[model samples]
Target: VLDRQGLDAFMRQIRSKFESSLIQDEKNERFPGYARRRWGGALKTLLAAIDKV
Candidate 1:
């Protein structure tokens, strides 16, 4: 039993957090010798590409 306003607010909050994290992660990705193992060097992909130097 959720109200319309309450549901909208909840969704907005979730979106805000998700967008913020995505932005930060992208920023971190644009660097030399950036090592990303688990989550992949960059997102929006099917598999992760490991960087080995």
Candidate 2:
């Protein structure tokens, strides 16, 4: 039980870090624009599929 609790805590920390990175990325205008320009079609297709659901 202790091991499981420790693992859960570790996973939560990792998830928090990942969320922070995503927030940082969203705040970055240049990175987002570049990504959109590079993968505009794919992104749009993905968004459409998501919307359908």
Candidate 3:
């Protein structure tokens, strides 16, 4: 049970982590495409789930 502010903070944290992962994927050479695709899907699903709520 998160209040509105808590929810916003949580979303910001998640977004930051995902953004960091994507940035790292761009910089690293190994499996960059795969990692980016997986994280991209997770980010999309997260946004969709939050929108539903």
lDDT at residue 29 of model 1 (Cα atoms)? 61
Per-residue lDDT of candidate 1, residues 1-53 (tens digit): 34556555655654555456655667686662333332332332222111110
In candidate 2, what are the lDDT values of residues 1-53, reduced to their tens digit?
23555555654654555445555667886675543343444444444544554
Per-residue lDDT for 1-53 in model 3, tens only? Answer: 66556666776876777778867877888776666576667768667766766
Off by over 4 Å in 3: 1-7
Better of 1 and 3 by TM-score: 3
How do the candidates rank by lDDT, highest first?
Answer: 3, 2, 1
lDDT of prediction 1? 0.44
Local accuracy by lDDT, each model: 0.44, 0.52, 0.71
Ranking by TM-score: 3, 2, 1
lDDT of 3 at 6: 66
Clashing pairs in 1: none
Error of 2 at 44 (Å): 26
Angstrom error at residue 29, model 1: 7.7
C-alpha RMSD of candidate 2:
10.9
Locate the minimum summed-lDDT window of 10 residues in model 2.
34-43
